[model samples]
Target: MPARIFKKSWLIKSIFFISAFIILVIGGTTYKKIEDLSQSSALLTQTYKVNVELEKIFSHLKDAETGQRGFIITNDPIYLDPYNVGRENINSSYAELKVLGKDNIALQNNLRELNILIDKRMEYFEKAFRFSSVGNYNDENFKENFYNGKKLMDTIRVKIKGMIDSENELLRKRQQTYESNLKVTPMFLYMVLLLSLVLMFITYSKIIRDLKKIKAANEQLEIFKESTKQSEIIGQQGNWIWDIEESAFTYSDNLYRLLGEEPQSFTPTLDNFLNFVHPEDVEKLQKDVDKMMINEDLPFIYYRIIQKNGTIRHFKACAKLHRNLDGKKQLLGITTDITNEIEHFKTLEERNLELERNNKELSAFNYVASHDLQEPLRKIQTFLSRLEDKESSKLSETGILYIDRIKNAATRMRLLIDDLLQFSRTNKSDKAFELVDINILLENAKQDLAELISEENAIITSNKLPTINVIPFQIQQLFSNLISNSLKYKSKDRIPEIRIVYSKIKASEEPQISNPKKPYYHKITFTDNGIGFDNEYAENIFVLFNRLHNKDEYSGTGIGLSICKKIVENHQGFIFGSGKPNAGATFTIYLPFI
Candidate 1:
């Protein structure tokens, strides 16, 4: 997806560059064409002006010739006036011709020759007029001068016509050039403009396509933004951005809600945000914010903020520096409402204190049971022993039986106290776990109950056990209790055959272990052929002070199995007992493999 976006972006850039290059090329071509056209037009205008000036010069000469002829024919004062005016006009025409043909050597030379011819003709005209004024109307000199003046006038007309023809040729060529330029320029510009339009249309199409994609992307962004907002609200979180370059802040809607205000309730600013901070944390938070500005980063910071309703809540925040493609710097930050976590922590702390007090009281009770409570039981046993030894003969059978009952009660009380103390001490707190061989612990348990096993003539056999991490003493106690329990409940008709089996098994294989915490467990089963009770009392038997039989039927303290349960629990293990009346009982214990 990223690659596709990059490809699209590169394509857009290429199109833009190509379009811009095309436009520049078109502008340059048009400018060059326009410049050529302007020069052609200016040249044509100059050619026409030259032709017009040439025609004006010739017309002025013609006017002077006509005036001279009129004076030679009439010899009147009006004719002299015209002749004088014509001469003056001829001189003015010569001056104008010189100025007009200054840059044309050929035209200037022609004008100079024409000037000589006009001067000769003017001399002939003056001579004729003088002869006529002296009454030499038929004089040969006057006739010859008049004929010479006519020939000179004809030569001047021929020279002026040649100059005019040369100018007309130049004007015709310039007109052809102007017409050719006008025809070719429009076609060239039209083709160029048509190509530019095609390029423009293509560029416009690409731009419109890109715009649609951008619109789609913007819509997706808006959806994602809304999703993020909902997530923040659900998770008790909020986000913000600090544009470091612009010194601007943008807070999410939830951020405003976190501060106990409506979204966009006011302009987001450091001062405005600071107003919601608790008075005690304001200075520390300000310092942290200052550090963030300097470092462009922020570590996890904890502070308290007071809502508008005056409820104080704990908040945790952190931020990192982010730089955009344009190299603008910003700090993206997230803040979480940790008030619930703080409250939970406080509750846990109070519970811990209460637990500590309870443990102290329990320890005091254990001390009393071990020393103070046991002292009287010991005295009672001693007194009963003395009475039985020294005064049993002096008492009646009933009194002796009463003394035996008292001894039994004292012994049971001692057992119950000892069991209770062991159960209390079977807690896991402060207990160091060590890797020990389970076989060794089992052997130790058997050794502790060696005398009882011998009396029962129990056949105890076990399989090899793996080494496991556990509280050693507690596990040893657990094994001893189970072995002793089996022995105490041995069926009178059969010799107790206790089998201790060990194996590694998956928790899933054990149907009794639901929602097992560990993947594997060390399974140790003690099966015995003993006076097993009904299976109905399997769970109840593990309860403290719960007995399946009366004291007369079973010389056992119910506290023993409860202690076994507690010890197994200390090692994060489970124990189950199953039995049938007058049949073998099986006790299974599962300890976590870890």
Candidate 2:
């Protein structure tokens, strides 16, 4: 059994040594290459993250300067939007860059200078705003501050550019390393195949003639029967060979075990096997077996089996016809316990039905919200408009005030209806994927928000973006909602400044995304200097109608963020929001791209 015939044959054993050495070489190469690839991937992630964060700092600083200038010229508090936004994001961007670049001494040095330049620019911006606040908006003072702030801004941009250039260089190096590993992996596979062929040739030379000389052909029949028992026992299954002419059967050892019977006690016969079949399945199982016998084709059957203890379980039987040496027919087959698999399938089926019902109910609710709820609000609003037009002077002050309250309530109801309808429709958007250029998408959203941007003197800066495969309309809706939400929550005393930028990451690197066939995701960030809410409400903000502020403080239906979340999910992406109160909110979207 130990192959003692070769126990003292060192020359023969060298073949095994060669095989092991080849395996070790192949395995060691794979391990080292994988380790190198992982490190390169991590370095690439850090490089891009640091580069993006630096751009974010640069972008926010510009927003602050723009906000300061807008407030100086128009003296509108809304112009401070970007100033407050820059204050909220600049520090966080620096912190993020520091963490991402902690391994690189040069980047850290660059970050230190970046911090100094941004601070200097911000200080001049504050002075300009301070002068304007104190009635110091003279042309000479304005020109002096303006020229100084622009100089500081230009210096900050130069420093940020240097950092970005260095990171791009690092990214290039890491990508080259990763590509080299990909090339080496194929060479490893080729070497492994060559080693396997050498081993196989050596083995064939030793065994080719000796196999015919030493082993009887009949040995296979014994081996097959014994293997059947071992396999059935391991799998909690059974096997049988039926002799068609003799009307007799041979059962594997585990066949008796499967029926909860004593081994070797029961006779192998058709009636005995049928006795174990569930009462309802007996006639069908018999009919299938008779058909398989006549047709001599492989047949598969799934039925319930009642064991000796009366517990019913699922079983799958498959059989193929064979011919004996004497030309007599035989049926060789296996049966497996499929109770657990059957139960799991049933559970999933029930869940699908339940989800179908829930979808129908939701559709009905949306219909009611569209028709029943909105019609009455429309009537109230139309009547109020008519009364206000025809009875302005005749109406008493109290009457007018009551009419105004009714109109306001009706208007609020209309807003509520619209928000609800939008929320209900979020997941129902057409799922057709298209190549959506993010630059064009952002431009459309900007165009839509053009009036508000000019009214508040808001500043929006964006970097070159990518084209992503997504539901184009849904992605456009996502951009529009995120930008509008930022404008709506802008700080009262600061100008609204918004910056959009992106970083690329591998889907396998991010733990939250699952089953990524495409390796890359573009993390597009929308940061705004507005009255950001508490971090605890980050997820809560994406729930329908979950508002952090009173209606009087912020005029929103609070469903915009929820729609943004749904759209991201529809594209197999992720959306997240985080902010500190009064600091500003950052909405980060992860969308897959080629």
Candidate 3:
């Protein structure tokens, strides 16, 4: 009899192993087909991206040509802005194309040739601009350059079109491949799944016949019960069931633990569970429970519970009417502890109130600085001026020197007050962004510093700047501050030469920008041949009232760069400074491509 039992067991094990092996094979096959389909779809997406980048390259070229023509016709520097910006955009697009087509040698070769052609075309644009700048539009050289640029543009268009057409053809083939895989995979999976189910059913029938004689079914039930208890503990939750017909309640083991008691420590009843609820919440919870009895359901309800140790916890509960296979109606309910969430919300509310109070204080401080403080400083300056002009002759030489000192002190104070007001204004909440020509802003800034520029004989040169979305006045202020800073720190030995260069750059290409918020940024750098500070103090220089040089050496409040930082931050941009002692400084600002 024992030998016969062993044979029966071996037969059951054999069937189970065979069924599992067949299912594993089917799963493996399905996975392979799915992977193939996914690869095909990814290839199709890559083809589309390549096409898009190619088109973008062509569009940027056209924009450059258009700008060149506009400049040729009117000889306006403003038109050159588009040309400059277009070149930057073209470079950015080409970089993206390189990354996208890194695996395709043909595409890489085409891109290389395309880049060369674009460079030649841009040279033609430069030559044309030079001729146009001198009003030589009708000259032979200008005419030849113009026609050559036109021909080059046409050639570029054909090259881009051909690349795009090639990508489109590749895309078409990939799409067909993807579609074929998509159509075949589902039918294959269905057939495999059907076969797996049949084998599983046969194995299940055999297992069931054997399990009917053993206690394995009861063991499975116990495993399920233990899994449910573990889930409730991990989730900080409890489950319960209510039998409406019998007016009985069944609580899970974790429910007792949730009440700070041992599992199964008390008989689960409606009144018994209510005993743990807080007095303030007990009444409301009783009403909800009563409604559940009548309506056979319970909407989500929030309440507080007091554990045996007197810890008050917030809870949220919900219930739904469910009928068992035995046709017994019960309310299945779950309750979760939400005390942490409630605490967090209260903390946030307090912080919000604190922020509001701080903002109000700042506003008050701004009013005082702009109005009350400036008024007294202005009066002091006015009185000092009167004293210097009228009482100078009657005063002794030492007294005259004292009066001069006071005048200088008062002038510095006035400058400090004005800078403070400007810094405060940078924090204004109402920021209006618009698409403005940065060249115009730069010109305006130069105009504001025209007298100073002329006095110092400082030479300021800049490349054509781009038109970008920015807070117009703020950007103008930023330009003014940077230019003024360079002028203020000019070297004594040589004339100050400040250069402003603009380009569009990818975030990944710039090491200073980590985890960049935008993919592209407009990088504008201010390079100056001034008495620059050490690189160690680069970040500190932008702090309000943080100056490298004493006030006696340099007439500045040190709030200028701070205001520049705030303005750039307000526009979701970044500003960085780098310098070498007694050499020069470069302040680079990156405005996002928004």
Listed per candidate, the RMSD to the true structure in angstroms reads: 5.2, 58.5, 52.6
Question: For candidate 1, lDDT tens digit of each residue in 178-214?
Answer: 7887788778777877876887787678778777777
Highest TM-score against the true fold, candidate = 1
Return the lDDT, model 1, position 68: 62
Q: Give every collision pair in model 1.
A: 491-531
Cα deviation of 114, candidate 3, in Å: 99
Residue-level lDDT of model 3, residues 1-594, one tens digit each, is 323434578777877788688778778978898889888888888888888888888888888888888887887788888889999999998999999899888899999999999999989988887888799878999899889988998999899989989888888888988888888888887887788688778768766766664555567777988998899998888999988788888888887878889988999988888899999999899999889888999999999989989999999999999987557999999988888889999999999999989989987998888899889878988887898788878999999898888878878888888898889888647877899999999999999999999999999999999999988999999999999999999999989899999999999999998778999999999999999989999899999999999887888898999999999998888999999888999999999997
| lDDT for each candidate structure | 0.85, 0.83, 0.89
- C-alpha displacement of 354 in model 1, angstroms? 2.4
Instruction: Mark the regions of model 3 whose C-alpha exceeds 4 Å error after superposition.
Output: 1-228, 242-249, 286-300, 319-332, 355-359, 389-393, 428-440, 457-471, 493-495
Q: Which 10 successive residues of model 3 have the least lDDT summed?
A: 1-10
- For model 2, the stretches where C-alpha displacement exceeds 4 angstroms are 1-234, 243-248, 308-310, 320-331, 428-430, 508-519
* TM per candidate: 0.77, 0.57, 0.57
Q: Least accurate stretch of 10 residues (summed lDDT) in model 2? A: 1-10
Residue 35 in candidate 3 has what lDDT? 88
Candidate numbers, best TM-score first, in rank order? 1, 2, 3
lDDT of 2 by residue, 458-559 (tens): 989999988877777778888889988999999998999899988899888878666875788898999999999898998899998889889987888878
